[model samples]
Target: MRLIFGLLYTLFFLGCLTTALFVVFHLLRYSLDRKVAVFGTVFFLSVFVILLFTNALIFFTLPLESLFPTFNTL
Candidate 1:
């Protein structure tokens, strides 16, 4: 059970990273102004990365027992 959850978490994190990369790629490829494109991509990616990390931290730190005590029986 723990292994499955770990695998799922890893996959989720990788998926987010892949999505951020795709967004950056599209921004750089489609934008007309080179400077603006680079700046936008960097700013967006940085904010995204920060938010992702914060979410992961919260997920891991959260006390699940308080929210779902029944799961402890399983």
Candidate 2:
């Protein structure tokens, strides 16, 4: 059902976002070069945020029927 799918989708997004955050935290905590760590964390977090937004946008805008025609029968 759509509800289940939506829940799973949200959880997946959150999981990925959290993973990205963890990576950023580790980079900032462990990296030797301060400038590189800051820059890398910013760049990586920006890319991850952009990707998450794009995916959520596409997921909401895309027609489920087009993606799975057979589901229409249900």
Candidate 3:
């Protein structure tokens, strides 16, 4: 169960990164104005990175052992 959640979390992060890449691609590829594209890319990336970092910090600090405690079995 513990390993399951960890794998899911990693998959979620990768999914977010993949989605962000598409967004960035569109922003750069379809924009009429170069300055707008550049600014949007910078702002979007900055916020995305900050949120991703903060989420990782919080998730790692969670008391997973207590949340998903293991037990001895016969």
Give per-candidate clash totals.
0, 0, 0
Residue 45 in model 1: lDDT: 84
User: Candidate 1, residues 2-74: lDDT per residue as tens digits?
Assistant: 4555588889999999998899999999999999999999899889989999988987876777776776678
lDDT of 2 by residue, 9-73 (tens): 98999899899989999999999999999999999988888999999998888777778888767
Please provide TM-scores, in order, for all candidate models, with all chains considered together: 0.78, 0.85, 0.86
lDDT of 3: 0.88
Better of 1 and 2 by TM-score: 2
Q: Which ten residues in a row have the lowest lDDT in candidate 1?
A: 1-10
Per-model C-alpha RMSD: 1.9, 1.5, 2.4
Best-fitting candidate, scored by TM-score = 3
Q: List residue ranges in candidate 3 displaced over 4 A.
A: 70-74
Worst lDDT 10-window in candidate 3: 65-74
The 0-to-1 C-alpha lDDT of every candidate, in the order given, reads 0.85, 0.88, 0.88
